[model samples]
Target: MPVTTQSWVVTQRLPDLLFAADARDEPISLTAADYRALHWAWSEAIGDYTRRTVTKPGDKLVAFAAIAELFQRTWRAEYLAGLWRPTLLQDLLWATNYEGRAPRPERYRAPSWSWAAVDGHVVASLLDDWLGAGVGTAVQRCEVLECEVVPATPLLPLGKVLSGTLRLRAAMVKATWDPDAQLPVLYAALDRLEEATLTSPPATSPAPELTQIGCAYPDSTEDACEIWAVPVLWNKAEKYAAGLVITPAATEGVYRRVGCFHSPEPDEDPGRLVWMLEQKKQEIIII
Candidate 1:
């Protein structure tokens, strides 16, 4: 003799339950552990839910919750919990506030530098304030040693990223934090100074050139940051040579990509920038 349940009543409560799924008593920081979990989740989920599908500002949270539910039974409980942490949720919302239509990778997936790579919350370094004048060569060249991914399925958005590796020939320099910018700033000495001209127009002045770029480290919460700025050929025709920024992880010789930094200034020929960096290219891996 059990009471019969009403379908309408259950339907009415569904929205409330979904919205309440992420309620928390306190905020949580995006720790190294959290970042690792996030990276894995993103690699698996982004293919199913393209960044282009996110239309509204609030859609990101809704999408995140849905993805978390899909992985609830498979992933560790702690890893799923990190996704809903109040601070992390807020950061995701802030980072996804792009004005125009999001960029979609022409290939099967999003590019590594794209937020689409990991459609989750992102937080910059908290210690960027103390950054002052700095000098040193950080990363000279990079090679994608290996990249592998499993095909996607109905339940899984992106199959699974089996293993990925990057080989970098870097100088490795301690970075300074720029508090105002809330990101680590690195001043790296560029190789082949004459090559720098490839990215810029005919020189108007002989100014001492330095590649000043912002860097992010996935798992690090340290004030004294170590970063590498590896040149990438983002667009050959536009002559766009982007800085694929990365930072070391706990494992020796292992690095996690932070993001890419490109100069805002217009370049007439971006292909030269790619050529300049390609001089050191060894191998390319499609992720």
Candidate 2:
């Protein structure tokens, strides 16, 4: 084994700044640049921490309680499972970083919407390089109506969660399985995603010419013949939208997130897909 002396001046600055910002007594409204920087820092921390191999898969959230506590105190915001409440919508858009990934464990860890629900490297899609560069803004298209995360230990809200529920008011439409669909991005919710075909026809026409506008990256590899798409963010300039793919739970109108869907509607006019989605907006709960 060889010991190497490394320069640490540059590496120390990030944490120094992070803690300094956290030490503030009051939360300050951040500018676009500040927000980008903050988002980047949190994204890196989350991605780095979750990617590490752990002896017990169930210890995911439990192991990160310390960081979560710091985040809660700093932002003075609600912590939902593995995401922050202030940016819950954007945070819910995390996806797997590789293909042919393993299926989720049978034992419950976290809600399907949370990255802690699955094993592997998951990246926050909204915090990608494009957002950092400010190329196109991610317009939030959904609203989180209600959220609840019951911790196993009542004294430790940031510790292991017994259960969670996320309810949203957003545009949702049925998506059928399409094995022949192509994936537009390398990092998706799952390694092998089934093509998502819209079951409902577009408002513009009685019959839609193109049904394969997106793909569903499920949380698990189990067979799913049908799912639902709920649009979360839209970048009108880029003709792109990112959202969740869900399936109905035991209770009607309630669903479980099976995966995430990324739709790049380059062929359709900007806002056209959004318009279609708006027509089908409704409230649904995810557990």
Candidate 3:
């Protein structure tokens, strides 16, 4: 059985500036043009983080790598040039209390979040044995569904691109599941994503089996999280919209009938779980 939890991934082509954290002494300055090459001394490296430092090595170097120009145009370009290493820490861990951990991920299981097919590549990096240079800590947090997290793993400093997403999961999950839920930096980044669909790939997907988890908070909340998504349509232009199905409110239609996850959010974690379901919906749109 797939152990469900909150997670997301970013997918994009390999960049030239991406260095190996294992090669701490390698050149860090790189442009999009250098993303892929046959030979580089330290191309494959994994970064590590502990809760002590304000910023880790991977954050420092990867941040520079994300922006090709930062290294090229800064007044201290030559001085900062020496800091380019794959192990650069763009994010550092902060100590916080988390009650439980996300269940160990199952193979080929649906991640708590999804992305365009291309973005899936970056998402897969976390599972790698060497684990790459930038994604470990947050993954560790996700292990416990540490709700207070910033979710920096999926962004990857954007190879200097620094972008966002389309729609994101509303923080309406069960308190039992989302523990310390709060708005995350990744929440805001989703905005850069196009509101409308960009793909029209046909939906030959098999019907997904629905596995309903009872709403953690129902009376004062929006709707419960969906168990799984079924491929009902493939038309990206038609676009998919999810909402709440209200039956009691009829005075002026203050409530939605269904698919109303538009923002202002729900009362609690039940909404958070539903939001994760919507994240899957967004993946369907992009796919």
Best by TM-score: 2
TM-score of 3: 0.19
Residue ranges of candidate 2 with Cα displaced over 4 Å:
1-14, 21-32, 126-140, 178-210, 265-271
Q: For candidate 3, lDDT tens digit of each residue in 1-287?
A: 11111110110232323323225554455443342231121122111111123133233323323333322322123111212222111111111112221221222111112111011111111112212223333221111111121223444332212222112222222111121232111121122222344576434544433322222111112232321222211112212212221222233312211111212223321223232334433211100
TM-score of 2: 0.76
Estimate the overall C-alpha local distance difference test score of candidate 3: 0.22
Sort every candidate by lDDT, greatest first. 2, 1, 3
Give me the candidate number with maximum lDDT.
2
Ranking by TM-score: 2, 1, 3
Candidate number that wins on lDDT, 2 or 3:
2
Candidate 1, which segments miss by more than 4 Å at Cα? 1-145, 149-186, 191-209, 213-224, 267-279, 282-287
Tens-digit lDDT string for candidate 1 (247-283): 5655665655444344222342222443244344443
How many clashes (backbone N, Cα, C below 3 Å) per candidate?
Answer: 10, 2, 48
Error of 1 at 78 (Å): 26
Task: Spell out the clash pairs found in candidate 2.
Answer: 99-191, 100-191
lDDT of each: 0.35, 0.65, 0.22
Quote each prediction's TM-score.
0.35, 0.76, 0.19
TM-score of 1: 0.35
- Angstrom error of the Cα, residue 181, model 3: value is 10
